[model samples]
Target: MNITFQKNAVTLLGTPLKEGEKMPDFTVCDNSLQEVKGGDLSGVRIFAVVPSLDTGVCDLEIKRFNEKASQYPDVKLYAVSLDLPFAQARWCGANGVNAVTTLSDYRERDFGRVTGTLIQELSLLTRAIFLVDDDNVVRYVEYVPEITDHPDYDTLEQKLNQVIRAQ
Candidate 1:
């Protein structure tokens, strides 16, 4: 059987996201199953945090960022993952991840296709981070080449600081 997958206009998986690109509006489900859309973050600096909560690296990434989220009071952090809402809620509950808002894109294919994070032959999202300003412009993006590796937190922190300072 031949299968064709949808491709994004931009390939972000192995490349750094350019600054000034407007982020595509997307709707994802929150832990409570309520729809969370990009419009809800119009005036907030958003961190599009992607991970696979079931994996060790992803768990550590979420935990680390959740801890750092407290320091960035002006920034809104959203932990985006492919895990089901129930699993995400359970994981956050057990890990005490109250600082960052966890969102799941499992129900929709927008995130995976629009962001180019969906693995070609797998049901997993690539480890990546996207920093969007209040105007919804993508300021910084990092796509870890190796799915098993963690993102560079220091670099992300620095960029986030820049965004905060600019605001």
Candidate 2:
């Protein structure tokens, strides 16, 4: 899909995963540099894809989600980024962001490619949000048209509530 990056044209490779589609499994590294595959994650997952954690908007977005994640213990809020595992750990520790688990896709960009969030020019994942059920089926997806903007958290919260209630 073609998503705008600060209103500039950018090409996102692969087909975007949508609602009701089973999320494809992929492996990514966590803070400890341990491989974490999609199957390794249990319960409902709320994936927040960001290009990088060093930027202002991405940092704020991650912090916001980290705070809101405490409300839903059953849901795993994954902050996906292209940052290295060491950098991710440092950022989490420095920012006191413990609620959301930070994942590193720097090695392979598997998550980016699978979700169709990879920016071809920048080689980074675009800002997006995905809600996958316990069954691994996607329940909601939000591809932010602009890379620097925040996601629609209100809609995300509503969808999360509905998905949780249905389960």
Candidate 3:
């Protein structure tokens, strides 16, 4: 069974995305499994952090961002993963992570597909970071090519600062 992976030139995951482009609206599940849509997050800068959450790098990334999220109270940080809502809640509870909002995209919402983070053969979401402005415009995007690598935090932080300053 040769499954042809639908590739999009959007970014690393082959989803069609570009810098300065308006981000597409989406609805994902929050920690409580409640529906969370893009509109619900209007008027706030969004730090969309995609991670597998089952790997060491992903764990570190979330931990680091969770700590840093506190410094930017104005921004809404969302840690997105394909993990089930139950797993997300359990992880948050076990780790005492409450600073950043945790979201799950595994309810057939195709968030991984839309974000271009879905691994074609592995059924996993690739690690990516998208910084969206309050108006839902994509200001910055970083998709690490290697699954084991971490995102470029320096550049991401720089763009985040710029967006915050612009507001």
Model 3: ten consecutive residues of lowest lDDT: 1-10
**How do the predictions measure up, each by TM-score?**
0.85, 0.97, 0.86
The numbered model that scores best in lDDT is 2
CA lDDT for candidate 2: 0.91
Order of quality (TM-score): 2, 3, 1
TM-score, predicted candidate 3 vs. hidden true structure: 0.86
Write one digit per residue (lDDT tens) for candidate 1, span 1-167.
Answer: 11122332223332234668887777889899999887667645555455568778878888887888778877777888788899999999999999878888898755766766765565666677888987789988777766666788888889888887888
Sort every candidate by lDDT, greatest first. Answer: 2, 1, 3
Candidate 3: count the clashes.
4
Cα-based lDDT at residue 75, candidate 2? 93
Cα RMSD to the true fold for all candidates: 5.5, 0.9, 4.6
Q: Please give, for residues 1-167, the per-residue lDDT of candidate 3 as tens digits.
A: 11122332223344645679887766789878888876667655555445567578878888788888878888877888888888888887887778877888888645676667766566667767888888788898776666666789889899999999998
- What does candidate 1 score on TM? 0.85
lDDT per residue, candidate 2, 27-121, as tens digits?
A: 89999999999877878999999999999999999999888877998999999999999999999999999999999999888888888988998
Write down the TM-score for model 2.
0.97
lDDT winner, 1 or 2: 2
Global lDDT of each model?
0.73, 0.91, 0.73
